[model samples]
Target: MNHWDKFLAPYKQAVEELKIKLKGMRGQFELDSSHSPIEFVTGRVKPIASILDKASQKGIALDQLEEMQDIAGLRMMCQFVDDIHTVVNLLRNRNDFEIVEERDYISHKKTSGYRSYHVVIRYPVQTIHGEKKILAEIQIRTLAMNFWATIEHSLNYKYKGMFPADIHMRLKRAAEAAFRLDEEMSLIRGEIQEAQAFFTRKKELKQEEKN
Candidate 1:
């Protein structure tokens, strides 16, 4: 248990630091009274059991666990599909970490009907020993896409990957529906942003009046 904790310490640190940094980007946009491409950020270090299962499934030796990019994962949710590209560009411009790879799952969705943009990065973490570089995966998706994926993930857990035929077909349909919703929302992006900005201003005014 101690060994496992020591091994994952850096990964946990990396997830925490990256979440704060990414959320700070959203804060900067808010400070400027501009729309932030990032709606929210969430992160996690894969559980030991899940990590072991994935390693075994992929024939990745324990010594080569670092090769598994998603052991430390972060999810950045955007309001619109276009915002995903904007966030990806921002990530590319940052010097804090090196992006090792990118997978455009939104354009080339998985066979199982998953859609998201995956960015694998090598992040440097400082420890008592020294600085260690670790692989982490960031998934960018729209709110609608996330909603569909979340349900699919839960179903995957229940079915253990071999979903019933009907369930599988329904999931595929749901994925497409989610994508269409994103497209429709994108068409009205300007209106949505304007309304949200107005709501925010109203809330700020109410708070100021209380103070």
Candidate 2:
């Protein structure tokens, strides 16, 4: 237990720090009264059980756990598919960490019809002894894509990756439907942002009245 804690401490710290920095990007956009490519950010360090399971499945030795790119994961949800690319570019421009690799699951989806842009980064965390470099994965996707992927992930756990034929077909159909939804929303992105801005100003005025 103590060994596990020590092993995961740097990963946990990396997740927390990255979450704050990513969320801060959205905050900056909000302050500028501009549309943020990032809608929300979420992160986690993989649980010990999940880490062990994945390591076993991948034939990774215990000492080679650092080879696992997603031991610490962060997700940036966007309102539209275009915003996903925008967020990815933003990540590319940041100097806080080095992006080691990228997987364009959105362009070439998985066999299970998953869609997302994954960025693997090598982040350095300052520990008491020295700086520790850890690999973390950042996933960027539109809200519609995220919704479908979340459902698919849950089903994967339920079926243990062996889905019934009917369910598999339905999930593939659902993935297409979600992508269509994202496309439709992108067409009206301007109108949506305008409406959001109007509502935000109205809320600010009401707050001022209360003050």
User: Which candidate tops lDDT?
Assistant: 1
Candidate 1 lDDT by residue in tens digits, 22-104: 99999999999999999999999999999999999999999999899999999999999999999999999999999999999
TM-score of 1: 0.98
- Computed on alpha carbons, the lDDT of every model, listed in order, comes to 0.96, 0.95
List of clashing residue pairs for candidate 2: none
Segments in model 1 whose C-alpha atoms lie over 4 Å from true places = none
Q: What TM-score fits each model?
A: 0.98, 0.98
Model 2 compared with the native: what TM-score?
0.98
